[model samples]
Each structure stands twice: as C-alpha cells, then as structure tokens.
Target: MAEEDTARHRARMQRKKAVIEERIARASLERGVFLLHTGSGKGKSSAAFGVLARALGHGMNAVVVQFVKSRSDTGEEAFFRRHPAVRWYVMGEGFTWETQDPARDAAAARAAWETARAALTDPGVALVILDELTYAFKYHWLDLEEALAVFRARPFHQHLIVTGRAAPAALVEAADTVTEMGLVKHAFQAGVKAMPGIEW
Candidate 1:
C-alpha cells in the first residue's frame, strides 16, 4: 500500500512539473515593473531592499531615496552604500511628528523627490527604491499627480519599488505589483523592543 502511494505521488509531481514548464515556456513578456509595498505591518521597506539586493546580484545599478527616515543606522543602508552601483540618498529631515513643521517637511519631501526623479530618468539605473515615499504623499508633503508623472516617465526598462504604509489609491492603481502586509501580531505589542538586523 505504501509503495502504491509513493508511485501515485511521483506521477502527480511529474504532471505538475510538466504544467509548470509549459506555463514558463508560454510566458514571453519582458519589461520593468512598478511594485508597491504598503500596510501598517512591518517589512515593507525590507522587502523592497530584498529586491534591490537581487538587482545588485544581477549586476544592475540601483538607487534608494529615503523620504521620511533620516537615520543612518540601518544595516541595509550601511552595506549597500559601499557598493559603487548603489546610489543612496537619505533626504528626510525626520518624521513629521519629530519635525513638527509642515513647511520644512514639505521642503524635504520636494528635495527627496528631485533626487528620486533623477534616478528614474537615468538609463543606467535598473532599480529605484523609494523608501517610505508614500508618507510624503499621504501627508500632502508631495503632490500625488507630480509623483505619478515621474513614475510614468521612468525608463521603460527600469523597475521602481515604493514602500510605506497607507499607500494612495492612485499609486495602488499605477503599480504592476502591489503587496499589502497585513498585521497579525507584533513583538512590540508584547513589549519587546525592536532589535538590530531584524527591525532595522
């Protein structure tokens, strides 16, 4: 009876492999994607950086523009900054609540957007990660229409990833791939503070 079950499982696996191969052969589209990662949960920016690492592994040039985080203590930022192909910019004055000045926050957002726009227009940049950029739009620090225009005008072969919570409806519609990280449970709720190499 066990031998019969094993044989059946082998047959099923073979059939699944054939179907997957057929689907792979049929897929011919090759183009850059606009990906958005957003939610109240964690790992949105971490996921974007994972893609950045993948691009770097493939010898592609990438740029990261941080909008609302001014700290330089992140492990990813520290590691990626050493690579010549990665252009990293942290343009935020700080979080909105920390800055407590609408005019100053808006100015920082505009400056970050300008840097991001340059990366988008550069043909050599294969991947552009706009870290926490949605906060700029959500807080009205940057114009949504202007941001969309830059995304639309980016090079045809350059991929863009935007990561933050409370992504705008327009951005969700514009993205080719959107992942919303839903909150289930968090360590912070249990009074566990964020640790390095995990939350950073």
Candidate 2:
C-alpha cells in the first residue's frame, strides 16, 4: 500500500545519509606530519602560534621549543606557558647576532634541539612547534641532517611545525605542508624598532 512505500523510502534515505556522513568523516582526518612556515615576512611565528592554540583548544598535547628567541619577555610566552595542554621550553639564549659568540650560540641551539628531539619522540605529544628553527640551521648551529631525521622518526600521529625566515630547501622538501610568506612591507625597513607584543 502507499503507507508501506513511504516507510521503505524513509529507510533508504537514512542509509544514504549515513554513507555520506561516513565519507565526510574519513576525508576530514588530519594526517600528522611535518609543516614548515617560512618567509621574509612578519607572521611566520604568529602562524605557528595559531596552530599551537588550535591544538591546545582540541585537548591535544603540544610542546613549544624556542630556538633563536629565548628572552622570556613576550606575552605569548607567558600566556601559552599558563595553558595546561602545553609544555614550553626556552633555550634562554637570545640569538647569534645578539650574542656574537658562535660557540655559545651553537651550545644553546644544541640544547634546544635536544628538547625538540625528546618532544618528537614522545607519544603523548600530538604537536611540536619549533619556533625560529630555520635561523639555527641557517647559522649552521643545528645539523640539518639530524633535524630532518628527527622529523622523519616522529610518532605516526605526531605533527611538527617549524617557523622562521628563509627555510632551508631541504626542510621545505621534507615538510608535508610548506607555507612561504612573502614580505610586502616591514616597519624595520623604515628604521623603526620592533614593537613589544607585536614583534616580540
């Protein structure tokens, strides 16, 4: 009868809807891997921090290791440290240009890299952010090959985010997601000093 036909049509529609939902779920999965954000622009670190916030918001475990920037004078550092989902490690050494000592800078870079390596190996760490890592590699303080090996050896579900200016070509090739931010304008070009909370 007409009533029986209506019931069967509803059942069929429900099955179709279930199938569509399954497909969507499968496609939206995040395949954990390495992501490199680099360029001569101003937002590389900001973009990395955005990923950090997103990971923390989702109840995922994250570790942030700061390389060239270790001055604990930034608001982001203070805020993120208070978050329960994040483990923050700072090298406490400013930078190569600031220190003007290659040996000291190399030692600091190595210490930070050690922390980064440990985070990559930890199964509980879902996200690892290496802030300004490119500069360390550029300065030849961190071994490029060793760093790439760590990226390759991370847990199956672990993701990494490396941010800085002029990312090495080797890193760009290895990253699953590579973003290059081109510099259109910068206040530093006009002899204006870096502003607090904005550039720090």
Candidate 3:
C-alpha cells in the first residue's frame, strides 16, 4: 500500500513539473517593447509606480516625470526623490481644472515632454514612467506625432509606462502590452474625501 501511494505521489509531482515547465517556456517567448497605458481606474499611476519600484529594486535606472498634480508632497514622490537610482522630475502644475489656463498647461506639458523624451533616449534609463501623460495628449497640449516618434525610436530593451485616464487609440495600438483598469467602485463617489497615502 505504501509503494502504491509513493508511486501516485511521484506521478502527480511529474505532472505538476511538466505544467510549470510549459508555462515558463511560453513566457520566455513573449517579448514586449512598447507603452503600457494603465488608465480607466484609480490605480493607473500606482501600478506604474509598482513597476518603478521593481526596476529600482533590480538596480535598473528609472525616471519618473509627473505631469499633472506635480506636488512633491506625495509619499511615493517623496520617497523616490531620495533614492539614488531614480531620477524624478515634476512639471509642477496643479490639476487642469484648477489651473483653468490652457496656454500655461500646454507650455508646462511641452516642457515635461521634453524631459520625458530625453529620458526615453538615455541608454542608462531602463524604465521611464510618464505619470498623467495621457492627459496632455487628451487635451492636445502635446503633439501626438512627436510623442509617437519618441516611443518608436526609443532604444531596444527600454520600457515606458504611461498612466492617465482615456488613453488614445493610436497609443494603444502602438503598445505591446495594454492594461485597462475598469472602475468597479470608488469611495470618492460616495462623497468620501481622499486621504493621503491611499488616494494621493
């Protein structure tokens, strides 16, 4: 009876090992080089930051440029600014609705895009995070043609993460991986105020 039990266990183990190996093989063949538009949910920028953390943990060079809501008070921005491996740049603009100035917003976005473009071309930078970049495109503050050019011309192995709501179709098509975070529920809708570390 013990021998039969041992044989059964060994068979199950072999089958599990085969399944694992198959998954690994399939994953190894998948290579992605493009944008990640994480919008439609509140965690879009947060997810991008998660990727930045992973890149920094691995000793890879990373750049984060926050476009809208560029306050330095955010916990993530505060922590990352002190890290030697990360280059952080803030466009330093309040929310678009708050600003109520189209010309100023466009100028700010252009400046931020210039910084991002430089980061994208830098061979030392393995990852570039463009936080709230989609808003610039959506508002027509940044030229879409030039933006697409930069992405296409980025060095091989370099990855970009763009976060904001309502990502354009062209940007989506250009991406190798696209994740749309749908809004299932939000506490803000219930008149609950945003708290630091959770909403900010």
Candidate 4:
C-alpha cells in the first residue's frame, strides 16, 4: 500500500476508536435487559438459544419455554437440557394449522405462560428465553396487558429474550433491545429442503 493510503486508514481507525470508546464510557447501567427478536426471517429462536448458551458458559441459570414448537427433539434442547442449570419446556401441541383447535391452542399457551411465570418470578434464574411467544399475542391467545404486567414484575436482574414473528407493538416498546431479522433470500424458497441439524 502507498504511504498516503496507509496514513489515511490509520487516521480513520483512530477516529472510529475514539467514538466507540466515548459511547462505551457513557453506558454505565448495570442490570439485565429485555431483548426481543422478531421478523419474517428465521434464526430468532436460534439466536436466543445461542444467548442462553453464552449465559450458561458464564455459569448463569436459564429457563426456556417453547410456545409454538411441540417438538422436544431439537439439537438445542438435546444439548442444553443436559445442563443442570437449564430448565427446558416444550409446551405446544403443534402449529395452529396442524392442531386445528383454537381452544386447545389457547389453553396450551396459558399453561406455557404459567410455567414461564414460575421462571420469571424465581430470582435464581439469570436468563429466560420465551421462544415463539409472539404468536400467542398475534393470535389473541394471550393478553398484552397481562403479559406486560408480568414482564414488568420479573426479577430486575433477570434477562428476558422473547422471539417470534409479528411481535406486538406494545411488547416492542417495552423491550430494552429489539432485533428484526429480515428475509433476503431463503433456500427453502428455492426448493432447498430444511435439513436436519440446520433447521432444528
């Protein structure tokens, strides 16, 4: 590289580092955060599970509640369930279309919420992942006010991760951090089947 180019790059990096350091220094709060991941794209729940793994590595206890997923055989569940500090629950009968029963789905959502309530109230749990929970609000199976109340009342140091598509506006407003995954191009749309170990 030319001398001028090298000097310019070094100056740009120095400026960037200054800005980053200033921002980091301003962020002084020390407490758990509520993160919501929602969108039409995939990997919302997967990302939450990844965070759970990170928390587990730090020796933090966690609870996972899978709302719209009935399968208990996923790779994440298989691996995380082995940990003594992790409490995993698969609390769905199946997808709505497969179940074909609104009443049953509502009941299942309520039951799952109850289990999640226990986790949220427990001070020992450091992280709680409510996987696919947005569907309950989208389908009107769970009330927004009730959920907001419970979320507000959860242990202050407990980090919460709620993942699913079509997240309600109120929940989005309540979250400390929100991520919306955008679908650019999916292999499934191009006749590529979802393979094991990748999709699960």
Instruction: Say which candidate scores most in lDDT.
Output: 4
Clash totals in order: 0, 0, 0, 0
lDDT of 4 at 122: 95
lDDT of 2 by residue, 1-200 (tens): 59999999999999999999999988876668788999887898899899889888899999999988868878788899999889988883785667888888889889999999999999999999999899888989888998898899899899899999888899999999899999899999999999988987
CA error at residue 129 for candidate 1, angstroms: 0.3
lDDT-wise, the better of 1 and 4 is 4
Tell me each candidate's TM-score.
0.92, 0.83, 0.86, 0.97
- The collision pairs in model 4 are none
Per-residue lDDT of candidate 4, residues 48-116 (tens digit):
999998999899999999999999888999999999999999999899999999999999999999999
The digit string of per-residue lDDT tens for model 1 on 151-186 reads 999999999999999999999999999999999999
User: C-alpha displacement of 179 in model 1, angstroms?
Assistant: 1.2
Give the local distance difference test score of model 2. 0.89
- The lDDT of each candidate is 0.93, 0.89, 0.86, 0.95
* Candidates by lDDT, descending order: 4, 1, 2, 3
